[model samples]
Structures are given as structure tokens and as C-alpha cells.
Target: MSFDSFLSQIKSKASELKTDVLKFKNKDFLNAAMAGSALIAMADGSVSAEEKQKMLKFIEGNEALSVFSTSDVIKAFSDFIGQLEFDKDIGEAKAYQALGKMKNNVEAARLLIRMIIAIAAADGSFDVTEKKVAQKIAQELGLNPADFEL
Candidate 1:
């Protein structure tokens, strides 16, 4: 191959590596975001298509989470949903555990709360059940639900 071609290849590979590294560093945050999304989506005992779309949109738009592919986000969300389906108490516990990881990062926690609220309202009706779940998620992240108008 030409030297320029080789250089281009290397730069492409480096960019891919950088993206991978960013995804790894933000994995915890991704999981936490998905967990919160799942909890709110399932709050009313039914996960709506709009709710799922809202989550994907948020992840695609968010700088920190944009590095992750849609499949990765879906898998994380599915894992939380599967756990909840198998056992509500256990699933909720696991979700809360994931959220608790961000308890100390006040900025991230606040952002998470906002994202959760958006997901809950994605159906165009943020009901009491979803509000309660959002509140619980804020609490898990050591945030104030009222701050997000939950």
C-alpha cells in the first residue's frame, strides 16, 4: 500500500480506538441512564414505543452517551427490562444499584434525573406512576426530584 494510504488507515483505526475508549469510560453512565429509562418506561406497567424512541434520541444527542451504538443502549435497556420482568423487586434493586453509582457525581446525577423525566413524559402524559419512579431514581442518584419538577 502507498505510505499515504497506510497513514490514512492508521488514523481511521485510531479514531475507532478513541471511540471505543470513550465508550468504555462512559459504560457506567450508560448503564445508569438505561436503567433509569427502563424504570420510567415500565412505571405504568407498559413500555411504550414513544418512550423507547425518546431514550434513543436522548442517547444519540447526548455528548457523553453519543459514543455508544444504538445496539449497546438497547441491550442495556433490555437487560433492565428482562430483570424487571423476571422479578420486579430484584429488577428494581439492580436498577437502583446501577443508578447509585452516580450518587457522588452531582452533575451527572442531575443530568440523569432530567433524562429520566424526559423519557417518562415521552408518551405525552407523565402520569403519577412515572413521576413516582422518576422521583425514586432521583433519590437513588442522591438528587432532588423537585429540582427536575418531578
Candidate 2:
């Protein structure tokens, strides 16, 4: 192929790759992230307003998650919280199922565990309950809790 044609082809391929990467930041990943965070937030009995605000701030500040809009993030987080408020067992099961989506990707799983830990400690108190929740999340992600010092 000619030089110009090759360059155009490369650009088109790059665009395709960019679109694929963007797909990873869709509602499925957002829902999983919010569910995991909500589980951790509720570990200590209830999710305080401060904890919610802190989680929202972290989500907004996170580069990987920033691809999504703030309203979408809030809605996902709220939906998970609502599920938990409605039924504990069902909520936890649903959250775990969401988190399971990241189990096959080591890097993503690790990042998720770290995010959960950060959320758990957001209120300045990472208690035993929170740690247990983090550990559970680690397990659900097919990772070792010890890796994150959980």
C-alpha cells in the first residue's frame, strides 16, 4: 500500500482500539464498581452521608472511572444502596455477582480491591467489619486478600 493509505489505515485502527477501550467503561463496569463500594460502605452497619460523598469524590477523581458521567455514577451507587436497603442477603448476592465480572482480569480485579479498600477507609475508620468486607471482595475477585493487606 502507499504511504498515505498506510497512515490512514493505522489511524482507523487506532480509533477502533480506542472505542474498544471505551467499551470497558460502560454501565456494566460502573455497576460492578458501585456495587462493590456499596457493599464495603455497608460493612459497618450503615452507609453514612460522609461515606457516600467520599466515594463519589473518589469516583469522580479516578481517571479510569471519569469516562462516565457523574449522574451515571450516582445512579449506579444509589441503585445498589437501594437494593441493600431493601434486602441484605439479596443485595449482597447481587453485589458479589457484579464483582464476579472482574474475576477473570487480574489487573482490574486488583484495582477494584484497592478502590473498595479506599472506600472503606474513606470515613477515617477502617474497622474489622470493613476489613472483612474488603476481604470478601478480594475473594470474589479471585484475588488474595493478603496481597492488599486486607
Q: lDDT tens digits, residues 1-150, model 1?
A: 999999998667546544543644588888898899888878877656775666667655554455678788879988998798789899999999999998998877877776577556655789888888988898889887888887
Which prediction has the highest TM-score against the true structure? 2
Q: Give the C-alpha miss distance for residue 109 in model 1, angstroms.
A: 0.3
Model 1 clashes, total count: 0
Which pairs clash (backbone N, Cα, C closer than 3 Å) in model 1? none
Q: Can you write out model 2's per-residue Cα lDDT over 49-88, one digit (the tens) per residue? A: 8867877787666545566787898888888888888898
lDDT score of residue 71 within candidate 2? 88
Give lDDT per model, in order: 0.77, 0.79
RMSD to true structure for each model, in Å: 10.2, 9.7
Pairs clashing within candidate 2: none
Query: Ten residues in a row with the worst lDDT in model 2?
Result: 13-22
